[model samples]
Target: MNSTAKNCAALAKRLTDSGLRPTPQREVVFKVILEKRDHPTADEIFARVKSQMPTISLATVYNCLETLVQCGLVRQVNLERAPTRYCPNLHEHAHFHDDATGQVHDINLPADTLKQLRSLLPPGFDASTVELAFRGSKGSARAKLAEGRAAARSGAN
Candidate 1:
């Protein structure tokens, strides 16, 4: 089978394993998420899927997203006071929310670091998942240059 067919089959198998039936809408939504690992909101996903499947409704996209999340096929990322976004990465990682660009990047954590974090919990407490997010501006080139110049002037004083 071709790559596209293989992907579809894999998606179907995953859905079935999760006791959910796979539909075209779900497949399309999954494809969009996998195509662009941009951590997009449901509306953004709707916009992208609509280009290919113009008949797709935003509600349908939302439903598909929920199903995918329920089935552990996608991760729901909630940034403070922002629309919920979806991520396809299944591995354990944190999120870096770029304040300036409004882009979300995955920050991979070392196994030891994760273990250290989990160890912080109390004896009777257990964490099923750990979510760590950092919000900051990924400085622009001009901003960095300005900072360098300002630092030089302050040092000369």
Candidate 2:
């Protein structure tokens, strides 16, 4: 079978395992999220789904997203005062919000780093999940130099 078919089958299996029936809307939304690893907001997802399934309503997209998140198939990344975004990556990682570009990048968290974070909790309080987000711009010298070179190259061409 083709990749799309395989993906649909996998989605069905996951949803069924989560005790939710997989519908076409849920499948499409999940596919869109999987297609683009970028953490996208509900509106962004609605727009993308609308293109393929013109009859899909924003409400339906929202419902599908809620189902996906509830079923543990997707994660909702909440940034302060910004729209909530969805992430398909199930691994343990943190998100870096770039203030300049308004983009979210996934930062891998090492096992020891996670252990250290969990260690900070009180003896009686156990943490199920730890979410760490850093808000800043990529203003490092290396990043600046790379941007300058790209601009110069583009201008030359």
Candidate 3:
């Protein structure tokens, strides 16, 4: 189907799967996350969502984010002394943070490398999830943003 139809179906499934009530605020918040995919902090999300949903409060955004996280529809990414960023990727991967721009990028880990890393653990050491974050320069971060913007523009046309 069309992109809009696909997005609506996906959003509906997400709300139902997460046991969320699918309120308008939550729907807007989730749409912002899906549209941006830039790992936005709660403040940033609130700002973007405000233009579309003028009546939404920052507190409501935070509550929606918390509910999404608790329901397993999103993951929280934390860096040293940095505000928590929300990520919707539930796959086994890592995050690369650009110190200069405060940008977060998803780095997909090799399956074999992940397996080897898991093998290094001692006996009876159980880990539910593995997340790695690296801090570095603006390498490739700018390119990714440009690509996202280009795609968005094309989709809008």
RMSD of 1: 16.8
Q: What is the per-residue lDDT of model 2 for residues 54-128, given as tens digits with 9 covering 90 to 100?
A: 999999998999898887779888737688899999999999998889999999999899999999988999898
Clashes of 1: 0
Give the alpha carbon lDDT tens digit for every residue of 92-151 in model 1: 899999988899999998889999999999899989998899988887789999988998
Residue 146, model 1, lDDT? 94
The whole-model C-alpha lDDT of candidate 1 against the native structure comes to 0.90
- Which ranking of candidates, highest TM-score first? 1, 2, 3
Q: Rate the local accuracy (lDDT) of all candidates.
A: 0.90, 0.90, 0.83
For each candidate in turn, the TM-score is 0.50, 0.50, 0.46
Candidate 1 residue pairs in clash (backbone atoms < 3 Å) = none
Which 10-residue window of candidate 3 scores lowest in summed lDDT? 3-12
Deviation of model 1 at 56, angstroms: 1.1
